[model samples]
Target: MSGKDTGHGTQRLALPGVFTAEQAAVTAAAIAGIQRADGAIPWFRGHHLDPWDHIEAAMALDAAGDHRRAAAAYHWLARHQLPDGSWYAAYADGDATRPTDRGKETNFCAYVAAGVLHHYLATGDEEFRERMWPVVYAAVEFVLELQREGGEIGWRRDPDGSACDGALLTGCSSIHQALRCALALAELRDDPQPDWELATGRLGHALRHHPECFLDKSSYSMDWYYPVLAGALRGAAGRARIEDRWPEFVVEGLGVRCVSTNPWVTGGESAELALALWAVGDSERAARVLRWIGHLRAPDGLYWTGYVYADEAIWPRERTAWTAGSVLLAVAALTGDEATGAVFGGAGLPRGLEAEECCDRS
Candidate 1:
């Protein structure tokens, strides 16, 4: 398309009521501006880096054709990966070599696969893919080590290396998608990982049939929509999941609430839910979700994290790289960006294993 949105032969991510080409580039530029020299994108300059959100910002860079910056971000991950194939939970933005938090989150560990796959799809960088395959493979193995007998991943590996008790619905759902992305990488390398396939099926089964097992976070909007967004629930099941929680989480002229309890609606959750809605074939509502969050976009092209409608204020008072990244990605999806659509829409993503094929027998 137009401007810097050339990665993957994608059309300019201009939605009718959402973003024009130049405006979309502005948003991408905002994220690029905040990125550090080492390619780490913290929540804001002062905030610490977390692996999952960091990868999300990197993917957004690739979407906008800032491929070099995106490559540097991935390389940062490679340099910092721990011996166990996991990254420490938080790295100080000022000095990434210093970890502020040492706990390794399972979902955070798994998401490198999704980011690697998305970047490769966008740029078709064979060298990058080759470099990243082992990183993804090791990360997947590390995450699977925490997979419970019931197929849900444990929340995190503590600094002492013990598995933390309990599975998170949102986190596991994200991991479900990551496992599939990892499988795609494995397949491309001509090395099939049947264990990952089985793990994917079991995890999907747990999400679809055994929701009671995950930590009860039903009050959060991410718990409501992440399964669909991550492709763990699809078809009629996915559509029904969206409808069931729509009234509780959606603010009419604003965006999706961060949690059901607050009047606070967040850009990241709202855009992710839009991607989820698009996956479920609800394009009309999906587009509306993006348009509703227009108020959150600042004059500088960065989006505020969330708004407090009850007080009519932008709470937390930060315009974050991840929020802008989520907005860019959702816009790209709605406007027919091929790479964005393929990754989130499950077009070219490898279908791991059917639930019946793997889980029923277990």
Candidate 2:
């Protein structure tokens, strides 16, 4: 299948075996409808925006060939950056918005690197990359400021600017991917951030070998699968990790559970798990995982956040742009989009700084 023209001034890319062209167009339109005039995409039409999810939605726009809107989303983030290069945890939904949450999360701050690089990769937009460099740089700096001696990153900073002491395995894993993307962006710009390289190496090391350094959120599916998705573990180790926890988190025909104990299967996690599976060369399983979430798709092509098996209903009753964003990302990865493939499959992203003394000196 080929790309199709959407009325929304974008071409919807088709991903056979994952999503049909019509489905992709519908999803793209759904995302477009929820995007604010300023290009910020909220969780839903009337919800708040978080940096991580906002970037996910923006990348979806890029995947759908809505470059202008994607660029607008990046600009929104750039415009709202704090002096320390971080954003408030959440913002109110609309034009007359205020910060709904004031805490700044390290992973959320760092994810702009991945988003900016994803946009650059998809569009090959040097000018856009140049424009976003400082935004990515400052955000990465803010995140690394929280890195500890043990290599795990502190999770969040309160509104008062005090850092939290603990870290999350999933969050650090996600940040590891962002660090790699940051390095890739630096490479594109003929800039070298040696400190970022070292930080990436240490962060990857902590994620792969030092679970003791992060908070125990083992019951969550993200903590189980994120290392693979983030490229911190690859090949045999990545395969083993996913297999080890498969029965615990996956719900077969339903989808991946948000948490092991919950009777809930979420669209976002399931789609991400599909991407993680694709990262490890398990395309068969990835396809299956993506297909399983078809149950969550609404008539308008937006996806319900999750299904509560206990109640047999959509748990949150909200159709989120990010959830649709995840589906588009997974589709892009599976359908051989080079940029999305690289970001998710570790094709050309930085391998993180090595832990040797030579790396530190360099």
Candidate 3:
């Protein structure tokens, strides 16, 4: 609320014990420092921009009470949206808006809806929501255009416009959550997208039952937990899913591993798992998981990407906006930020149209 007007009334983000007010402010400042004048937030100051991470950082900025900047970040996305409603996989360096990776990632395209809705929820910014609706709607169309008949969305589209043959568990799960947010936006506008709802329900079915549709990536922590975090799986089933992979992905007294074979425990993944845990009504476990990652926090309140257990050091010394952003989001969810809580805990967001059947065997 302290920030300049973005044509929408200003409102501050919720601050809870997820981190002290001081620590939260410090993290916010750190994030703000990396935001480009054009509103692009790269992974690090000199690093490239991925749309998903860019939005993550923007959300953190919003949580930190930098409302105008957060709104600017969304505007950046709207300004740069490709003709096809997608963005290149990566935009290199803040110095220019060039794409480092020209591939259009499916989940990355879909994520804009989640970001737009979260911003609207936090600020009650009707104008912001209205302006960004076309961007969100187009991004959703781009994502679902690649969804297969079996209900799994293809993972990416190459520069030449060919879709990737296989789906990814993590990416598809995230898209499921994004699709729900898109539905919520559509409903809010009184312009329901039945196709989106059906696609979402089908995508959810694929995420929960058709593992075969996605490339097998059991070793990666994201594949193990994102379904729960993304709301594709919930209740006892969700809790059981995390328990099923707990031993493989979580490092006791440390944090969640980036991969089963790696000695690395990543702050982003760990914080995300904490959010997932909270979504399933396991707040205590979520807090413990989040606390374990404090080891990855830098003196400046910025979080390191991961800690390498074998090296006994932060493997990637660089502080990433997304890593800090994940922590802020997890804390927001824990501290009861209604929008953050609703997004992560799968409340308030549309649940999508239930598929006629759970799984399409064909």
The TM-score of candidate 1 is 0.95
Pick out the ten consecutive residues of candidate 1 with the lowest summed lDDT.
Answer: 1-10
Please give each candidate's TM-score. Answer: 0.95, 0.95, 0.94
lDDT of 3 by residue, 46-107 (tens): 78999999999988777666788899889999999999999998988743457889999999
The segments of candidate 3 whose C-alpha lies over 4 angstroms from its true place after superposition are 1-18, 357-362
Candidate 2's displacement at residue 226, Å, is 0.5
Flag regions of model 2 displaced more than 4 Å: 1-17, 94-97, 357-362
Off by over 4 Å in 1: 1-11, 359-362
Candidate No. with top TM-score: 1
Summarize candidate 1's per-residue lDDT along 11-49 as a digit string, tens digits.
Answer: 477787888777877888788887899878887888888
Candidate 2 lDDT by residue in tens digits, 149-186: 98899999999989988999999999999999999999
Error of 3 at 63 (Å): 1.9
Give the Å error, residue 53, model 3.
Answer: 0.5
